[model samples]
Target: MGRMVPAKAAFAGLCSSLVGIGLARFAYTPLIPVLIGAAWFSPGQAAYLGAANLAGYLAGALLTQRIAARVPVRPVLRGMMLLVGVAFLACAIRLPFAWFFAWRFAAGFAGGVIMILAAPAVLASTPAALRGRVGGFIFTGVGLGVAASGTLVPLLLEAGIAATWCVLGALSLVLTALCWRSWPDAGVAPATRRAPPARSSLAARAVVLEYGLNAVGVVPHMVFLVDFVARGLGRGIEAGAGFWVLYGFAAIAGPMATGWVGDRAGFGTALRLGFVVQAAAVILPILTTGTLPLAVSCIVMGAFTPGIVPLVLGRLHEFAAGDPAQQRALWGAATASFALFQAAVAYGLSFLFAQTGGAYAPLFAVAAAALALALAVDVVARAIGARQVRTRRSVAA
Candidate 1:
């Protein structure tokens, strides 16, 4: 029972993330052109709808911890999963733009709530030594959803868009059922005490800020990558989707690979390295859009997309110092920060894409710049932390 508990909790987290982010958020990427082509919406409307999800994600992130405080964590997790499933089914009908937007927003809201709450709920039961690996497994659901959507969306398109939405909705509900009994009922109870002061420490703030900036770094690829390959670069939708598939495959490997690195070299070190590599990848399109360069760019960017989540979580766990309540609070704040930036950037970039007349290079350039700035902030924060440790050690001596 002891061993089974952790395993089941981890599996439950995985299913929640797969539904919340994987299908709810990422599955829409490949469908942009399909929505436009089917005359369901114009290109600009499709882009704005994508932004709507991020807006709802922001709302969910801000509210999750507060909701968890009043309600049990397990029911909240289950409800959010079911909400995402229903959102997909509701979106299947070809309705007014407002109707689709509302459903997309609902799905995004559920994703944000799940993303904020699920990992911490599971990790509360995970052993300290295994948290990194367990977290990696939990987030791998996002990549799995991505890979599944990338591969399945095109095939399902043959049947029609409504059918594709139905299939995704059904899959989400099935996953929810499989994990229904697996959640840890007592793992993430409401906090009755105040968090430690360390929650506001320099390193903790830096991690949250860096996470927010990462949201900026990812917006271009998340929002525009498929459209860029399809319409901006003059590749057909099939070729664009091929790149998206490549992205999904790379994403599948990202979290586990980074988690292994975090366990060995330390989460902080892995995070800095990720920023540098991601910056390089984000800028590749600006320098050249050759097939090889684009492929390399997509592979690297995709891997780090969901890959950074576990790294950030592990780093924050270290700061929380084994206090599950503090960890949840810290993580909630970090997630809200991330969602806020992501929502703002998504809307801003969508506007920029329109202003620039569908130009893609500038978008990538902006993303790369955000990553570079994140790296700089992280470096300064680490330096200050190390110096503070040294000062404290000297004083004790």
Candidate 2:
């Protein structure tokens, strides 16, 4: 029984993330065309509806820490999961544009709250040696949810759209029930008694900036990769969905692989390498439209999408010197930054897509540029941090 406690807590966190982000957000991607084809919403309206989720995500990220401060972590996590299931069910019926928008937003908000609170809640109680592995496992839920959507959403669509949403809602509820008793009784509030080191603060800020830019970098693939494959390349929805499946499969490997690497090579090294590889992947589509190239792009981008989260989380843990309170505060700030950039870039890309008569290439080009900038920022920040360390040692001598 004692041996299983940490595993159970990790499983609970995974369920929260799976429902919060995996199903709540990615499930809507493949459904974009269905919503349009069925005359449920115009293309423009459908695009904006996706953006609404990001907007709500931003709101949720900004508020999660504050909410947790006032409430216990376990119930907040469970309630957010319940809210997401409810949102999925609410989205089943084709109501007014406002109705769908609001539900998507609510679902997104729940996802943000879950994303902010879940893993940290588990990690606080995790043994130090296992933090990376457990953190990686917790985030696997996002990929599992993504993979399930890619394969399951299509099968569910056969029964019709409304039924599909209802099924997703049902699955979420079932997972929630299974994990209801698994959460650790840890509070998420950061301690106000001590400030983090000045150098750590600087490094954390640099990492946060990089993470926000990464959010911009991923928007192209996250929001439009399916549509690009489906319509831009003249492939049908099934083919586009095949790419999403490839993405999902790659995503499944991303977190675990990266976490293993972080546990050995250091999170900073893993993250820097990831930025380079993902930047290349993001740009591959613009350079070529060949079958091999697109597949490679999808796989690489998919792996890094959720993979990078664990690396960042692990890195923040390092920066905080394993202080849970400081780690929680830094992570909350990082999430809000990511949410802000993701929402802004999502809306900006949607507008650009419309303005350019649905051009997809330029959007990817812009994303690649954002990633390149992120890599440069990380390098400069690391250099400065290293210099500060050397100087401090010299003065002490």
Model 1 ranges off by over 4 Å: 1-5
Residue-wise lDDT of candidate 1 within 1-397, one digit each (tens)? 1363467888898899999999898889778879999999999899878888988888898888678778778888899999998999998988899999999999999998899889988887677667777888889999998898788887888999999999999999999999999988655676666666774399899999999999899888776887899888899878887898899988888887888788778898999999999999999999998999999999988888889999999999999988877888789889999988887887788789889988888888889999999999999998988898899999999
Worst 10 residues of 2 by lDDT: 190-199
Predicted structure 1, TM vs. truth:
0.93
Q: Per-residue lDDT for 1-397 in model 2, tens only?
A: 1363377888898898889998999888778878899999999898888888988888998887677767777888889999999999998987899999999999999998899888888888776556677788888888888898788898899999999999999999999999999988764544445445534677889999999999998888877988899899999878987898999988888888888888778888888888888889988999999999999999888887888899899888778776665776778888999988888888789889999999998899889898889889889989998999999999999
Best by lDDT: 1
Colliding pairs, model 2 = none
Candidate 1 lowest-lDDT run of ten: 1-10
Give the C-alpha miss distance for residue 202 in model 2, angstroms: 1.0
**Cα-based lDDT for every prediction:** 0.87, 0.85
